[model samples]
Target: MLIPALCFVVMITAVMQTAVVPLMPDIATQLGVSPNAVGWIVTANLLTATVCTPLLGRLADRRGPRRVLLCILGVVLVGSLLCVAWDSLPVLVAGRALQGMSFALFPIGVAVLRSALGPHRLTAALGIMSGTMSVGGGAGMIAAGLLYRDGDDYRRVFWLLVVLAVIATALAWFVVPDSPGSGTSSGADFWGVVGLAVGLSALLLALAQGGTWGWVSAPTIGCVVAGALVLAVWYRHERRFDAPMVTPALLTARAVAPAHLAAFLVGIAMFVQFLAIAMFVQVAPEQAGYGFGASVLETSLLYLLPGQVVGITAAGVSGLLVRKFSADRVLMAACAVGVCGFAFVGFAHDRPWQVIVAVAVLNIFVSVAYGALPAMLVEHVAPHDTGVANGINAIARTFGSSLASALVGMLLATITIAGTDIPSERAFVAAFAIGGVTALIAGFTAAASRA
Candidate 1:
């Protein structure tokens, strides 16, 4: 029961992170903002989540999962409610900040699963846990679309999130076993956490908004430099402390850095592909978007359904692969599949089946890559510091997301045919090719990692 419940926590957070994908154009129409400006809604949330994840993971190390879980749920619940109350786009962005904090559930859930679940369940447990994100992402899109006109208004979607988040919060407090070392540890390096959080937030903001601000803008440059300085000081401080907030020694350890580097590159490659592929698949008629002539909700359903199905199927079969082969091997093969999928996307023309096949293959690879990463990290790191180490992993993913948002956004903005405002298929082709090449390189990196 708790195992499934743990998956629920992450799935729901994923929904919070992604629910707006289907609604981005809708939100822009509603707010009278440009679609590009509307991109900030997702970018803001990811950037905030990027900065706070490490802080929250470290907090969980000291305070325990129960407390961290409850608090995050509380944030999500309030955030949902706030979204309903606030009509302004900026205010909505603020609510998303709270929602972004909800991502702590991912790392915190992994921590609890490690401490409570028996070894027998570990392999199946990890894969299924990752599948929840796929499920949540799919379900969120479908529900957002269906609920938008499924005899209910989009407001119903907000109300539903508020209700479900609250329910999850209540259940987490009661059902989760307040396990050992589940919460905050002593002398928890408060300054270190604050500096990292602030630094990362500024850095992510710079990256996310840099496109709008002009990359050469003083604000952009200042934010980047400030973030670097804070992190520089953080690395120095961590080197001297026992049980440092981030466990710096692991980062520099001969074996660990290579594995971490692989994870970091994989994160960047996957996220760019995720954002780009989905948008390209549904490319608007004028822009070579899928031209499916589908409604937003309808398009979202098509966009989401295949990925969810692939993730679920992979979870069920992961045990076989893990028993017979190494997780590193599984990760490499998955990356290879992702590269193939992206390549197909570059060439996917009118054939809907082609799109489906590529998406399915990509989802499988993504499921395997993310599902296997933390397990690999845990194999090498001490139990007590796994949360922090995984925090680094989470950072890798977030940093990757920041880069993707910027890169994809700039690419889209760049490739729009001059004066037509439509993305040239040729430009999109280039983007797809770049994504495919990046994925192939990441595959090689994963295959070669010492882990």
Candidate 2:
């Protein structure tokens, strides 16, 4: 029950993060905003998540995860309600920002599982929880498509999310047991929080908006430089300051650093598969010289859904593989699959079956990485540090995904079909090749790591 409950929590957060992707155009139309303005719906949520996840994770560590988890679910529920209650862009973005706080649920849930589950049970529990991320991503896509297929009212989707949030809140309340606090820290480092918030927000904003701002544009370059400087200063401050929010030692621990690096690279590979593949399958062959001409619903059901299903199964298998070999070994093997998967798709996307198989194999890589990376990091950290450590790891993954989104957008837009705005086949090939190379690098890094 506990495992299932936590899995639900994770699944819903993942769902919330991705469900709005297909509806961006619809949202833009209804809200009477430019496509650029609608991008903020996702950007706001991501920015909020990047800033708040570690902070919320710290709160969970100090206040007990169960209480904090409930609070997060409550916030998500309110966010959904707010979305339903208003049609304005500002209001919806505000709601999404609140919903973004749910990203902390993954770290906090990891902390709870560590405290509640035995060593033998923890691996499988975590794997299932991790797998739900993919499942939820697919589910969210499907749900949005299905709900909107009948009508133009996107509010219907938020209403469903509201219901799901309510159920998740109730289930979490009843099933999740309370864990004791760390009892070591009585107060937070105010300056540390401010620095992290500003630095991460600036960096994430730059990444999220880079494609729109033009990579070399003044605003993008300024943000990158400013963010880097602030974060560098923050790191130096934390290293020397007593009672820092996150210790320098923990951040750079040999056993943990590799996991974070692997997470970032794997995340980039995962989103490349998602964004590039989704676009490739949906491109009209007559216009782009390749593609299946898939509708939104068809794409979700046939391409994305199959991969997500395989990802869920692969996640469970990852736990078993960890017991037999090691997490690093599983990661290496998974990334090998990704490298092959991306290569195959790049060369053989002419057939629908090839695309389906390619997506499934790539998702296997994502699920296995998601399952194993946390185990690698959590095993090396103290129980009390689990939330913050995993929170940071989650942020690394998010940052990677954001970067991937921008890069993929740039690549796909680099070479358009003759007169149409559709991306040419060559652009997709380049994107796939980049994804494969990223996976290879990630795998090599994992193999080299001591952990």
Best by lDDT: 2
lDDT of 2 by residue, 140-255 (tens): 87777677763478888888889889999999989999889776573558778888899999999999998889889999999998999988888899888887787776678788
Predicted structure 2: lDDT = 0.86
Q: Per-residue error at 346 for model 1, in Å? A: 1.6
Query: Top model by TM-score, which number?
Result: 2
TM-score of each: 0.90, 0.97
Provide the overall lDDT of each model, using Cα atoms, as 2-decimal numbers: 0.72, 0.86
Off by over 4 Å in 2: none
Candidate 1, which segments miss by more than 4 Å at Cα? 28-40, 149-154, 182-188, 284-291
Candidate 1 per-residue C-alpha lDDT over 1-451 given as tens digits, one digit per residue, 9 for 90 to 100: 8877877777887677666676776677777889777777777777678777777777777777677778888888888888788767887777777888877788788888878877567766776776565456656766777777633434567776787798788768777888667444645677777777777878887888899889999999999999999988888888876757777866777545655666666666666656665666566665554445456565556765777787778755664565457567777787788788888878884666676676677777767777777666766777666666777777776776577667777888788866876666676667667667766776777666743
lDDT of 1 at 316: 57
lDDT of 2 at 273: 87
